[model samples]
Target: MPVYTHGGDIRTAQAAYGGEVLDFSANLNPLGMPDPVRQAAAQADCAPYPDPLCRDLRRAIAAHDGVGAEQVVCGNGAADLIFRLVFALKPKKALVTAPTFSEYEEALTCVGCEVTRYTLDQDRNFDLDEGFVDTIGPDVDLVFLCTPNNPTGRLIDQDLLESVVKRCGAVGAVLVVDECFLPLATGGPGLAPWLASHPNLVLLRAFTKSYAMAGLRLGYCLTANQDLRERLGKFAQPWSVSTPAQAAGVAALTCCPHWAAEGRGFVEGVRPGLAAGLTAAGCTVIPGQANYLLFRLPGVADLKERLLTRGVLIRSCANYHGLGPDWYRVCVKGEAENRRLLAALREVL
Candidate 1:
């Protein structure tokens, strides 16, 4: 059988460097999984199968966001939902920001969709410009915008996004916004507010990031367009979300305030500490509201191997569509962990 690998495969990294390694490559919540959510999984019944449609979890999320349950679609994870959305829509041509999440392109390609890239200028700190609306028009069927976008950790202007959505809607394009990292931003809401106005808009969210439940594989999509949700539901398999995942997701939604607040606080508190450390070590840390920070080492590629040898795993951005060798991204971790990573990186650099 042929084998394929995705970036941030820890087992592959572990094989290369034997030992428990701190994972900064993946932009996950560094505060770790919330205790209440973990506890909920333990009490959930595993004997019978989970709700095929994730009824309870959907209700919880809908109530939490003040949306109708019918407007919500739960999936195994955000990635699964993204894939289903792409498959259901079956866009012939899609537009995505370069250096964004890899899964978007992979999923689009699986549906025979051709994708176009809008590269973010490194000098501009990879911020999305109003030009995005210009690139997405009648020719495009899907438009993906990642706020506080991956790797770059830059956000698109909210008004600009709204305008882009309007343009996409006018041209019958589906506007998909990935707010997976939105919780990390200081002033932004999770794009839930705009769902009513833009019926063509689809907001992708997950308990995996802010709620620290990545392993639980809990994710959902919110849209005012009932038919899109129905199409996604039809394409999704029965019980795509497991029993424990449903329980954990409900717990996450109910207990979201505590966990989200704590994770945000941890990232806020550690941002300066990590930035200072990186700056001291002669790297330029880009400013952002996300839990992860992007830094350009004076010469990061030169030190990648040495950092790996030190049992420290970091995301080297050479593989990212628009990013170059000097770029790297790391999730904001706990205090001690960040300190340890900074120490290792200092030595490596």
Candidate 2:
């Protein structure tokens, strides 16, 4: 069986199942891409070279994020930014949480940085706590955190986040908070308010999940430290963000203010029932506030494979750092998709 790596695995599913696949792996905007974003992408005159600096898009992102344009750095995606930051900082030692996104470890390892995992207790629902703050010391040079964390989707508490940020600042460790899923995350007042005070903080965000433009590959990071921003420029190649993606990003922020909010509200409305349905289907669903739900089915070792046979592709969280083969994460999609997924589970179970 092909390994279920990331979401939007329709082609892989088709090759294996030879049938239509309802993808619940990628946790994107349930409403799909906004029309304005599509239009902006379509209208992008790609004939000329892209603005290597991505001036206009950065400005728009700045306005939306309430940061100076100089503080913003655009990239193909958050993963791109991750690698770039890793290369730029070249930190000797770093700290990351377990059961979170894998890119941080991948990026850090690529640069030969020693990574220490501060494991989140899965029994406590994989939510970060105060003790994680202690992991940030003078010895640790970089830290990665995710709000509405991947695979598990539980949010970081604001106070806990502050402690982490403050602790990082005290030790001069650069804290990279990946808030890519924050817009869809309900009740998440993101840590943007701390950027002004803490120069060591980097808020990594992306338009892929929130704007439903995964194909466009639009992502950026916010930081107050001019040296860090300038260092990113030194490491990143020119035109790292393509023209159409740039246009789409600008449109996502400036042209469509409520687009993210719409997706957030829609996910908020649908996620509870989906969690309930998963629980009813004999899975221990981790109640999350983001656009996806993470659950565990104890007896179904090959649940992802079985679902693929039914033309349903849900993320197998087996590969996530602190998770196991029994765990899975599925996006909270629209009604028809959700219904088909539940029906497939009913049969496969």
Candidate 3:
């Protein structure tokens, strides 16, 4: 399978720039990983192999989401589950949002599936509208959606989302919604509650971003279909999740119910100032409800390099399907770090 380019590669930046790089490329929690999760991970025993089924972690996640344990399946990471779904279902055709996460297309192509794109309008700030539902048809076998979508950081409207889900079900197409960023969003109910009503709907989530556990490689999927869950498990490798990752995930969900809310509130509080700062620096900031913001400015093609010279790193959205070199994304970090980024942008711009 072809690899997808992602953010948060501080090692590469350090090698190239030879300095301390403040990365706004990856949209992770800036508050840092929780202490309880760290303690749990440190205390976990790695001498024994991890539970292949992730029994304890699944139960913890199920209890936290108020869903049945049978409805949940854990994976090495969200990416692992994404590939597993594509391999298991082997859909002939797939529909996905352009400029969203790249893995959906990569996995689909790996299975020799034909892919179609529904490009979101830049004029609309990349928001999904009612017209998206029209893109779903009987010919499509699968659909992928990312809420508070990557690169653009725009959430799907609840009404529009429901309409799309219903249309996909009617057409007999499976709908997979990526809710990895949902925990960092300020408001709106997650899609977990809809699992009972929409068996075709698979909700994907991870502790990588919300709990700052990216290195742990932990993620999960929620579905009401037992057969589908079984298929996913069959396709996955044995003991995919490490013992420490499972321990950390269980601890995170059990001990840090308020961590997500706290991170959301912190992002919501600081996002406005970040937007204002970027705008004053002469960039057109795309307003987002997530923990990150997408913006465009003149000479952005070279802006990333300029910021790198100053020990700051930002994501260039040019690689995302529908975005050009003019587009960029930055995480809404803490006050001091946000100010540092703004200062670097002001000088570079």
Candidate 4:
């Protein structure tokens, strides 16, 4: 399989450019990791093997989400769960959104599944409207929807999402919703609440972005279907989540309940300034609700390299399907870092 191209590789850029690089490529929490979660991970006992079932971690996640522990299944990361779902279900026909996360396609292709894409229009800011419901027919055995979607950062409309659930249910199609970025997006209510009625819905979440636990690799899937959950667990390797990751996941939820709210506040406060700056620099910025912005500028395909020379790193959207070379995505970072990024863009753009 070809390796996937993703953001947050400061080490590689540093090696190539021979300098410190400010990474706006990864959409992590700008508030940084909570001290409690950090301390918990550091203090975690690595001597013994982690719990294979992730009992305590699942309980914590269930409590946090107001769902039963039976509905939750932990994984190495959200990507792991994505792959597990695809492998377990072995859906011959699957539907996904174009210019979204590549992992969906990667996992589906590995299983030799027939993948269909519902391409979102750039003119519509990549929003999923009512028309998307029509695409989820009886032929599609599985559907992948990423809300506050990657790269573009546009969210799926609530009514439209409901319609999708209804359509998928009518067709007996399983719907997997990627909500890894929902916690960071203001006014973004995740679809976990809909799990009770929609047994076909599988909600994917992670501590990687919202809790700044990317290195720890803690993620989970929530579903009301007990059979599907069991199938996912059977396909997954034993003890996929590490000791530190489990400890950190629990600490993040119990110790820092307000972390998600704080992150949203920080992103909302700084995103406007960052978007304005990027727009002022001659980039057509996509108004995104998540803690990131997607924009396109003249020569954007080469702009990532030019900015790298100035010790800065940003995600080039050229690899994403339905997006061209001119598109780029950047995290809404702290004020100082945001200022530095704008300054770098001013010089390079």
Q: Pick the candidate with the highest lDDT.
A: 4
Candidate 3 worst ten-residue window by lDDT: 1-10
Estimate, for each residue in 1-349, the C-alpha lDDT of model 3 and write its tens digit: 6543688889888988997799998888878799999999999999999988889999999899989999999998999999999999999999999889999999999999999999999899999888889989899999999998987888898988899989999999999999999989867688888999998999999999898889999999999988899899899998999999999999999999778889999999999999999999999998888999999896668788899999999998888898889888999999999999999888876
lDDT per residue for candidate 4 within 127-168, as digits (tens), equals 887778888888899999998899888888888888999999
Native-to-model Cα distance after best TM-score fit, residue 250 in candidate 3, in Å:
0.7
* Number of colliding residue pairs in each model: 0, 0, 0, 0
Per-residue lDDT of model 1, residues 1-349, tens digit only? 5443333567766888987777887777777777888999889999998999788888998988778888898898999999999989999999999889888998999988999999987778888888878998798999888888887777888788878888988999999899888876655766788788889999998888887777788888899998898899888988899999999988887875567766777788888889888889888888877888888886558555677788888887777788778878888888898998999987776
What's the TM-score of each model vs. the native? 0.95, 0.97, 0.98, 0.98
Candidate-wise lDDT, in order: 0.84, 0.90, 0.91, 0.92
Q: lDDT of candidate 4?
A: 0.92
What is candidate 2's lDDT per residue for 1-349, written digit by digit as tens? 8554777877878889987778888889999998999999999999999999899999998888887888889999999999999999999999999989998998999989999998888789988988898778899999999998997899999888888888999999999999999999998878777898999999999999989999999899999999999999898887889999999998889878788799999888888888888999999998898999999999677999998988899888888888889999999988777888999999998
Model 3 steric clash pairs: none
Error of 3 at 155 (Å): 1.1
- Name the TM-score of candidate 1: 0.95
Once fitted onto the true fold, the runs of candidate 1 whose alpha carbons sit more than 4 angstroms away are: 1-8
